[model samples]
Target: MSGKGDCYDNAVMESFFGTLKNEWVHHQQYQSRYQARSDIFKYIEGFYNTVRLHSSLGYMSPNEFEAKYHDNP
Candidate 1:
Protein backbone atom coordinates (compact mmCIF):
# COMPACT_ATOMS: atom_id res chain seq x y z
CA MET A 1 0.00 0.00 0.00
CA SER A 2 1.10 3.58 -0.61
CA GLY A 3 1.59 6.26 2.01
CA LYS A 4 -1.05 8.95 2.30
CA GLY A 5 -1.57 12.76 2.63
CA ASP A 6 1.36 14.44 0.95
CA CYS A 7 0.92 16.97 -1.86
CA TYR A 8 3.65 15.45 -3.98
CA ASP A 9 2.27 11.99 -3.47
CA ASN A 10 -0.84 12.93 -5.43
CA ALA A 11 0.63 15.41 -7.85
CA VAL A 12 0.60 13.12 -10.84
CA MET A 13 -2.87 11.82 -10.13
CA GLU A 14 -4.22 15.29 -9.61
CA SER A 15 -2.69 16.49 -12.84
CA PHE A 16 -4.15 13.55 -14.75
CA PHE A 17 -7.65 14.12 -13.37
CA GLY A 18 -7.42 17.82 -14.06
CA THR A 19 -6.49 17.16 -17.64
CA LEU A 20 -9.20 14.55 -18.05
CA LYS A 21 -11.91 16.82 -16.74
CA ASN A 22 -10.70 19.87 -18.57
CA GLU A 23 -10.03 18.26 -21.91
CA TRP A 24 -12.69 15.55 -22.07
CA VAL A 25 -15.23 15.23 -19.29
CA HIS A 26 -16.28 18.84 -19.11
CA HIS A 27 -16.96 18.83 -22.83
CA GLN A 28 -19.41 15.96 -22.83
CA GLN A 29 -22.99 15.36 -21.80
CA TYR A 30 -23.95 11.82 -20.81
CA GLN A 31 -27.37 10.31 -20.31
CA SER A 32 -26.18 8.09 -17.51
CA ARG A 33 -23.26 7.28 -15.26
CA TYR A 34 -22.51 4.16 -17.27
CA GLN A 35 -22.17 6.13 -20.45
CA ALA A 36 -19.81 8.56 -18.75
CA ARG A 37 -17.78 5.68 -17.40
CA SER A 38 -17.51 4.01 -20.80
CA ASP A 39 -16.58 7.25 -22.56
CA ILE A 40 -13.95 8.16 -20.00
CA PHE A 41 -12.44 4.71 -20.20
CA LYS A 42 -12.27 4.88 -23.97
CA TYR A 43 -10.85 8.40 -23.92
CA ILE A 44 -8.07 7.54 -21.52
CA GLU A 45 -7.17 4.08 -22.69
CA GLY A 46 -7.96 4.14 -26.39
CA PHE A 47 -7.09 7.70 -27.28
CA TYR A 48 -4.98 9.35 -24.59
CA ASN A 49 -2.59 6.53 -23.81
CA THR A 50 -2.32 5.10 -27.29
CA VAL A 51 -2.79 7.94 -29.73
CA ARG A 52 -2.41 11.33 -28.06
CA LEU A 53 0.95 13.07 -28.43
CA HIS A 54 2.23 13.87 -24.95
CA SER A 55 4.39 16.92 -24.58
CA SER A 56 6.35 15.34 -21.74
CA LEU A 57 7.17 12.38 -23.96
CA GLY A 58 8.76 14.76 -26.49
CA TYR A 59 5.48 15.15 -28.34
CA MET A 60 5.39 11.51 -29.37
CA SER A 61 2.44 9.19 -28.87
CA PRO A 62 2.93 7.04 -25.75
CA ASN A 63 2.83 3.88 -27.84
CA GLU A 64 5.55 5.19 -30.13
CA PHE A 65 7.81 6.19 -27.26
CA GLU A 66 7.31 2.94 -25.45
CA ALA A 67 8.16 0.92 -28.58
CA LYS A 68 11.30 2.96 -29.23
CA TYR A 69 12.45 2.63 -25.64
CA HIS A 70 12.03 -1.14 -25.64
CA ASP A 71 13.61 -1.52 -29.07
CA ASN A 72 16.69 0.54 -28.17
CA PRO A 73 17.09 -0.72 -24.65
Candidate 2:
Protein backbone atom coordinates (compact mmCIF):
# COMPACT_ATOMS: atom_id res chain seq x y z
CA MET A 1 0.00 0.00 0.00
CA SER A 2 1.02 3.60 -0.52
CA GLY A 3 1.10 6.50 1.91
CA LYS A 4 -1.01 9.64 1.66
CA GLY A 5 -0.55 11.97 -1.32
CA ASP A 6 1.21 9.32 -3.47
CA CYS A 7 -0.14 9.37 -7.04
CA TYR A 8 2.28 6.66 -8.10
CA ASP A 9 0.25 4.11 -6.21
CA ASN A 10 -2.49 4.28 -8.84
CA ALA A 11 -0.64 5.51 -11.89
CA VAL A 12 -0.95 2.24 -13.77
CA MET A 13 -4.73 2.19 -13.35
CA GLU A 14 -5.03 5.83 -14.34
CA SER A 15 -3.05 5.14 -17.49
CA PHE A 16 -5.17 2.12 -18.36
CA PHE A 17 -8.49 3.95 -17.96
CA GLY A 18 -7.17 6.90 -19.94
CA THR A 19 -6.24 4.62 -22.78
CA LEU A 20 -9.60 2.85 -22.63
CA LYS A 21 -11.54 6.09 -22.79
CA ASN A 22 -9.42 7.48 -25.60
CA GLU A 23 -9.46 4.33 -27.68
CA TRP A 24 -12.94 2.91 -27.11
CA VAL A 25 -15.35 4.55 -24.68
CA HIS A 26 -15.50 8.06 -26.09
CA HIS A 27 -16.13 6.79 -29.60
CA GLN A 28 -19.08 4.56 -28.84
CA GLN A 29 -22.70 4.95 -27.85
CA TYR A 30 -24.52 2.62 -25.49
CA GLN A 31 -28.21 1.84 -25.70
CA SER A 32 -28.31 -0.15 -22.52
CA ARG A 33 -26.24 -0.86 -19.45
CA TYR A 34 -25.93 -4.53 -20.36
CA GLN A 35 -24.74 -3.70 -23.86
CA ALA A 36 -22.11 -1.34 -22.54
CA ARG A 37 -20.86 -3.91 -20.09
CA SER A 38 -20.65 -6.61 -22.73
CA ASP A 39 -18.88 -4.40 -25.22
CA ILE A 40 -16.34 -3.15 -22.75
CA PHE A 41 -15.68 -6.70 -21.62
CA LYS A 42 -15.07 -7.78 -25.18
CA TYR A 43 -12.81 -4.84 -25.89
CA ILE A 44 -10.65 -5.60 -22.88
CA GLU A 45 -10.52 -9.39 -23.12
CA GLY A 46 -10.63 -9.95 -26.86
CA PHE A 47 -8.63 -7.00 -28.17
CA TYR A 48 -6.76 -5.12 -25.49
CA ASN A 49 -5.32 -8.14 -23.73
CA THR A 50 -4.70 -10.16 -26.87
CA VAL A 51 -4.00 -7.82 -29.78
CA ARG A 52 -3.12 -4.31 -28.62
CA LEU A 53 0.61 -3.64 -28.36
CA HIS A 54 1.76 -1.86 -25.23
CA SER A 55 4.89 0.29 -25.16
CA SER A 56 5.58 -0.61 -21.55
CA LEU A 57 5.71 -4.25 -22.52
CA GLY A 58 8.14 -3.54 -25.36
CA TYR A 59 5.36 -3.26 -27.94
CA MET A 60 3.95 -6.69 -27.19
CA SER A 61 0.35 -7.42 -26.29
CA PRO A 62 -0.52 -8.51 -22.76
CA ASN A 63 -1.12 -12.08 -23.89
CA GLU A 64 2.27 -12.25 -25.56
CA PHE A 65 3.99 -10.90 -22.48
CA GLU A 66 2.22 -13.39 -20.22
CA ALA A 67 3.06 -16.32 -22.47
CA LYS A 68 6.71 -15.37 -22.66
CA TYR A 69 6.93 -14.93 -18.92
CA HIS A 70 5.41 -18.34 -18.22
CA ASP A 71 7.57 -20.06 -20.80
CA ASN A 72 10.75 -18.67 -19.25
CA PRO A 73 9.75 -18.62 -15.61
* Candidate 2 local lDDT, residue 63: 88
Most accurate candidate by lDDT: 2
Task: Flag regions of model 1 displaced more than 4 Å.
Answer: 1-6
Model 2 lDDT, residue 59, Cα: 99
Candidate 1's residue-wise lDDT over 9-72, tens digit each?
A: 7888899999999999999999999999999999999999998898999999999999999999
Model 2 off-target regions past 4 Å?
A: 1-6, 66-73
Report the lDDT of model 1 for residue 61. 99
| Deviation in Å, model 1, residue 69 alpha carbon | 1.7
lDDT of each: 0.94, 0.95
Tens digits of per-residue lDDT for model 2 on 1-73? Answer: 9988788889989899999999999999999999999999999999998989999899999889999999999
- Model 1, poorest ten-residue lDDT window? 1-10
Where does the lowest 10-residue lDDT sum fall in candidate 2?
3-12
lDDT of 1: 0.94
- Each candidate: RMSD: 2.6, 2.4
- Give the winner by TM-score: 1
